[model samples]
Target: MLVHHLYSGGKDSSLAAWVLTRLGYEVELVTVTFGLLDNWRFARETAKRLGFKHRVLKLPVEVLESAVETAIRDGHPNNAIQFIHEKALEALASMPDVVRVSDGTRRDDRVPFLDLPKARSLEDRFNVAYIRPLLGLGYKTIRELTERLFIVEIRESEELQKADYEVELRHLLRERGIDPLEIFPKRHYQSRVLGWKSL
Candidate 1:
């Protein structure tokens, strides 16, 4: 009954984990890091606030390097970001006790999404369930739910220290003297979960 939720300490993923718990599954917030930064701590903190068990998984650094190269070659981070997400899902599915893996992919999200083919492939290859609690929910509904259920802090992606892949990707890009803003979109807002709102 334990489900590993790909958590980024953001509203959508946080809400997704919460919804999974409501549906009678024990949710564990799993944050993936590339060892490029310590931003995973932010996710651990939010997981504590939600009272969910949390752990950090370190992915191969070569994978992150490849993502950075893809972003540079494509002049954007969409596919590169998606690449990391898919890899993360695969990693979670391959874990010893991971029978079900979940992510916060929403209806309107373009990047970091699992298409039908990929989801089916993962489930088939690993004999695991690919769950997306927020897949059927749009941005508006997700926002409303988060507003009612939790306290959230919103800011520009560059300023926010959430545990999403973009943060590490951007950091690697900056270390290579390539400005992340050159590839990432302008005015992208990211949210961080602070605590729950009591009814």
Candidate 2:
């Protein structure tokens, strides 16, 4: 029974794994490499530091680009990110050692996105858990938890460059003048896409 954490090698995702470990779940970190993530060292180091298993799932940049490009070609350019997240989830769920998939989604983040059920939709029929221990806690709180646990060192990223999807979407969001929340669907964070409650 391999428990997987939705790791982005960023503060939020890393914090999610940290919190879950304290809660007594057997957690491993999964880093979905989308773009030029020159190195996968962060996931490896963080997992080793926290004593959790880590794996890198390399998503083909071409296929990912094709999906987004197709959605754009179909006239829903703005929804590219939504498709990207969906793509990531589809790929993430296929791995063998993933009994549970956990993410760094937060309490403050839930109200807008209502992501609980979104996470659970990836669950396998075999009873895998999609966990989110930081569902109600904000970025600040997650950071606090990290600091309290003396894991702040994980936040330092030495990446040579940012992920392309991250850069492009942020630019689009800026151009649209919509908060990132607008891009996030306000859906449940579990198996059933029940309407979300702002926690």
Candidate 3:
């Protein structure tokens, strides 16, 4: 079956894509861009290294910003992050010939996680399977496995301005003269694979 893996060039998403490949699925690495700034090229490079096809989907900055604004008003960035993820899934589910959609969400992931109810509804609505290969693994295990398979560059989330959903949203807010700190929490981290070495 064909699987569209939501890729971020980060450990979890990369590992999720790897897992799907190992399971004999034809995997395509997909990175969604919110039309402000993005590090999607890194994800494309990682997909090339892993021998997978890559796609970049662009979403309107205004759409994502609305979600961020709502989340900030609600007192948590998780709501904004999850909103973007759900929208991404919804977009992927609408694509022709895409029967399976997957992401890097883990059991311990609080932000950007699709709850069971949402997952079921997406499946029912789109007639597609939503897969999260890293859903059962914790951060420690994911880190260990990633170390063995890829050379990664870790950085503070704020430093990687276009690396993930939150960072991109922060950039948008800043461009509009709003303080990101007024919305997002402190001390977030992000990772990207520099290269992969055979284990």
Candidate 4:
């Protein structure tokens, strides 16, 4: 069966796509963007390196607006990012061709983690399977696997323009005369898949 994996060009999502491929599923990497930036192209490049079909889905700009508003209200990006993640999943699940939707959300993820209740709701509403290939793996194990299978470039989120939701959120904040650094933690590092480590 075919599975669409929400990819951010990061190690976790790349590793999740790899795992889904090995499990005999035809995996396609899909990146969600609000059209504010071309960051999704970075994810498309990474998908090419991993040999998975890739595409970009443009969500309504209101999605980013809502997320940014939430971040501004909460004084942190956590809840806002989680809100965007769930919305992205919902969009993917509702696609006519999508029977199964997956993401890189792991046991250690806090911001974009989908709990059992939310996952069940998604599945029940869309009549599609919601899969998390890395759900059972923690950060350490995911890192080990990614290290062995791919070459990754890691840097502070502001420094790396990968396809994750944060980039557009930051841009929107800046456009509104708000500094993203105030909402997003400065210590956060984002990864972009460079290529596969030659086996």
Q: Give the per-residue lDDT digits (tens) of candidate 2, residues 85-169.
A: 5555567666665567666667765221325466555564435666667777766766565555543322111222222234344
Estimated TM-score for each candidate: 0.98, 0.62, 0.93, 0.98
Q: What's the number of clashes in each of the models? A: 0, 10, 0, 0
lDDT: which candidate is best?
Answer: 1
Worst 10 residues of 1 by lDDT: 110-119
A best-first ranking of the candidates according to their lDDT comes to: 1, 4, 3, 2
Error of 3 at 85 (Å): 0.4
Misplaced by over 4 Å in model 1 are none
Tell me the whole-model lDDT of each prediction, alpha carbons only: 0.94, 0.54, 0.83, 0.93
Instruction: Give the per-residue lDDT digits (tens) of candidate 1, residues 96-140.
Output: 999999999999989988789988999999999999999889989
User: How far does residue 7 in candidate 4 sit from its true spot (Å)?
Assistant: 0.6
Residue pairs in steric clash, candidate 2?
106-135, 107-135, 107-136, 107-137, 115-189, 116-189, 116-190, 117-188, 117-189, 117-190
Tens-digit lDDT track of model 4 for 28-135: 999999998898999998888878899999999999999999999999999999999999999999999999999999987887998899999999999999999999
Give the Cα-based TM-score of candidate 3 against the true structure: 0.93
The alpha-carbon RMSD values of the candidates against the true structure, listed in the order shown, are: 0.7, 9.6, 1.6, 0.7
